[model samples]
Target: MDRRESGKTPRQLVPVVLTGAMGKYGGELWDAAERDGRIKPGRGPNFTKRVLPDLAPLLRKDALDQGIPRSAVDRSDRPTRGVLIPPEEGGPFPERLGPCGWSSEDPGEFQWDIVTRGRAHWLLARDAVATGWLAAAMHGLPHWADSEPVVFFSTHTRRSARSRFGAKFRTPPADLVTVRPDPLFPELRSVDAATAAVQCLSSVMRGKKTW
Candidate 1:
């Protein structure tokens, strides 16, 4: 019989809840769990397969209304070569451009640029719901109520902050940890965010050091 069932104090087990499980960052967290032999197949219907398709149209429309051009929408059936605007001479242009084509040139413009990308929108919408589901599941798990679970978010933004999923982390019980690699280490930064998060979590779990 389980110790808890026999009136013994339940062993404390820290459960790691990864928000962007299928995304680049979440994938790293999953891998980290695998290395620690803590990986388990997620329960319930696949969120991406069963839920995302139905929501994609609504999300796509929202993106369009948010200034994202239809052309930027990612389509599974075709390739999307995104637009790239060259930097103006002597203008304040960022040295590097992100996947969504935004740079450090203007914060306001960069914010819009991010929402306009279909890929970005898709990822955001999916993550929003996935985290919600994770939160609910964690609440239902045994002994979870007694300890706070670590939630790793792949990314966030001002807009996402207002989203239901984002709001969850912003508020209570969930210990939200944004997994980012140290920028000073170029090699580490080059790796996926998920991998970096895993490394950091591993370090913390081992009580070796704080991230």
Candidate 2:
């Protein structure tokens, strides 16, 4: 049934969604939006921060549970710290990054069946699933089967480039656009990079003839 016919207003129509908002790419987009007056206080796509924990331990346990030989599972890359840390402890630098930790009460929910080295890919997959669910719930729909365009700003990492997690959605939006920063500007700070990226995206969104 149509929402209007059902006499219920949709929770809120999010015209734009910025995923990985805390990461380099997403952070850039967010900062740009703020600077350009596009985003106001409490007005924008739902901000979802991607938080990762050390996945080495969880992956090792998962491998063992899957009957993999102990020698086969590499423990050399095991993380020494959890994702969450005190702000005073030089918060969340590149060295402290890890996989998104599981918070489900059920132990079985924390399975690491995907045996790939792409921790970022795994995290992105989880994020896609979560956003899909959120869209469905907020719109009172069964799934993300609509044609609304979603603009995603991601880094130029190989894992993110090769990730097929977007397709995992039951009905992925066809107009989804992924924006990445120019490789030439590798030394650009987050805010600077974001400013450029957001400008490009804004042009595209405005139907301008530039990339």
Candidate 3:
């Protein structure tokens, strides 16, 4: 429910939409992503990497070692601008790579990496703040469930921004959302411990159980 599945445009993958890079195809896609840090060593990139709201550029930059395939795009099927196409999906994942090799994804954390957190940076407004369960995860809390939807609170995003990208967004009193650099990834941020705790508790008490 939190994913960006709305709008009349086709959000699913289509050929030549992104001028895809010559992706790894079969297992190579994951391999390439891992090699480029688009994904983690033993974990996939969610392939959408909504883990941090600002990770889109970092993730996209980590990829594209190869060039995207060229093809004639049909005018009737041209993708709408500003659409939320998941990364990699728009790439050259052609059947050619399908026969390259036999490989299997480690099912263990695949969903957590790929689905639990979508491409948050693209879906969220640039100034979004990680809060609630996500803040706990940012703080390195253990036993936090990945099944829980990532949550955020932002004052800068438009009111039209919906709860998508595997996360929920809210506008709160500006001072209530104190932020600090994420201890794990200093480049990103999370609500401070107290703020995270309060927000997490507030969600729980309010029965906001969409996740």
What TM value does model 2 have?
Answer: 0.20
Q: For model 3, state the Cα shift of residue 202 in Å.
A: 2.4
Error of 2 at 120 (Å): 8.0
Q: lDDT of candidate 1 vs native?
A: 0.26
lDDT of each: 0.26, 0.27, 0.39
Model 3 steric clash total: 6
Going through the candidates in the order shown, the clash numbers are 1, 3, 6
Q: Please report the TM-score between candidate 1 and the true structure.
A: 0.18
Sequence-dependent TM-score of model 3: 0.43
For all predicted structures, in order, the TM-scores are 0.18, 0.20, 0.43
Which run of 10 residues does model 3 get worst, by summed lDDT? 98-107
For residues 1-211, write the lDDT of model 2, one tens digit per residue.
0110122221121222223333433344345434433222343332322122222233455556767566544422331111111112232332112122211111111122111112322333333322222222112221222222222333322232233222223333454432211121122111222343444455457875232
Q: Which candidate tops lDDT?
A: 3
Model 3 Cα lDDT, one tens digit per residue, 19-79: 3443423264545533443332233323232122222322222223323222212111211
Candidate 3 residue pairs in clash (backbone atoms < 3 Å): 20-68, 21-68, 46-113, 46-114, 50-118, 50-120
TM-score ranking, best first? 3, 2, 1
Q: List the residue pairs that clash in candidate 2.
A: 52-99, 52-100, 53-99
